[model samples]
Target: MGRRRTGEYFSLDDAIIQGQIVRVRCGACRRAANFLPEDLAAVYGGSRFALEPLFPCSKCGTTDFVRVTTYSPEIADFGRITLRRPGPKKLVQTWENETFTERSRSNYVPDGDFRF
Candidate 1:
């Protein structure tokens, strides 16, 4: 979606400067990173959306991009606080192959079962 002049709560520039939560994803490389307007205004000074044309994909050397979600700590998703205490520690074995990671809700399965 095109950047809106006024977000549900604040303007795009306000979301960038004050919210500290502007992000964009590379259309080619798909790399996503925090976009700080404080950094952008230096080289290209203009309305934030206007500067969208100047943003180049640092990963793929292309200008293609799409703005992603901008998160503000003051605003909670769907209106309520979403942060919760950590659940039980995960069983992480670094030496094992990454495919061995157990995502299923079942009890622990052996590493051999995880290999492709």
Candidate 2:
């Protein structure tokens, strides 16, 4: 059987091509923000993924109350609306060191004895 079409747009790429912008609102905290569809698609996955499941509110960190909607911006809405654009990605490198001494070795007991 052929796949059924669910909505007007199949993917984020489709939405972007149609000049749609994504808006997310958090019910609990009343926090709202707009984002570019391409920015979200880059972070979460490719354009084939749905936009709704990709956002968790940055402030509240809850997906339960998040609402995702896409709309094409009007000329009047240009300066009035602010969008959260993607920033430069930062790669942090961390190094951990482990030291072992005779005292530390004595704390290890075999046979699943966890007493220290």
Candidate 3:
């Protein structure tokens, strides 16, 4: 069977089934990173989700210039390749003050009332 499509692009599930990892790079900063398809599928809906709009370079934060590719790593790449892994979640609480104020309206002058 052919690969499933989300709009015009193939789904991330296709890559996961093919045992491929997603590589994202920032063209402006030249920063690159590898991510697992399964992990992404879980967070980004399911395997059928479009791979587009998924990669926004964390370092440079440029989604327009980001490039996404997929490949199966070779055995020799085990030590050389470094994947971007998720870190522990932290929750912090903050307090904000809310104040309500009424604005005063400015006096209005019509165009005909103005003196040259």
Candidate 4:
């Protein structure tokens, strides 16, 4: 009924490398934005699965987001081919389409680049 959870698309480290941005909406105001990894790291000290323990909306001071997702359209479209998450535009307006690149976004090395 909503955007898929983080675990559905990626493991913790995979989120960091592949998540171009995180899309989240305020529970009370319905305000939403595309947050880059740097933005989330500033708030949660990490990018993966960090939206929990909800923080207040800077605009409304509400301590919750109604929905969240790793929003990358190119990946989403590609994911659908493999039955992963739906495209970002199908659910959110703030997410921009990630242009197709031949390089695999699945460069999730278990030990070299990410710890977990």
Index of the highest-TM-score prediction: 2
Which is better, 3 or 4, measured by TM-score? 3
**What lDDT is reached at residue 89 by model 2?**
73
lDDT of 1 by residue, 1-57 (tens): 234454344345664565444556666677766544555554455254532535567
User: Sorted by TM-score, highest first, which candidate order results?
Assistant: 2, 3, 4, 1
- Candidate 3: stretches off by over 4 Å: 1-8, 48-50, 96-116
User: What lDDT would candidate 4 get against the real structure?
Assistant: 0.52
Output the better candidate (2/4) by TM-score: 2
lDDT score for residue 5 of model 4: 57
Clash-forming residue pairs, model 3: none
TM-score of each: 0.40, 0.68, 0.66, 0.43
Over 9-106, each residue of candidate 3 has an lDDT whose tens digit, in order, gives 66678777787777877888888888888877888855554456585677767698876777777787788888877778655545455554453224
Best of the candidates, lDDT: 2
Q: Rank the candidate models, highest lDDT first.
A: 2, 3, 4, 1
Q: Which residue segments of model 4 deviate by more than 4 Å?
A: 1-3, 6-13, 75-116
Question: Model 4: which ten-residue window has the lowest total lDDT?
Answer: 79-88
Report the Cα RMSD per candidate: 13.6, 10.4, 13.9, 18.7
Tens-digit lDDT track of model 2 for 1-116 = 11224464457776677777777788888988888878877877545544465757788777999876777888888889999997787665454556877677675447543332
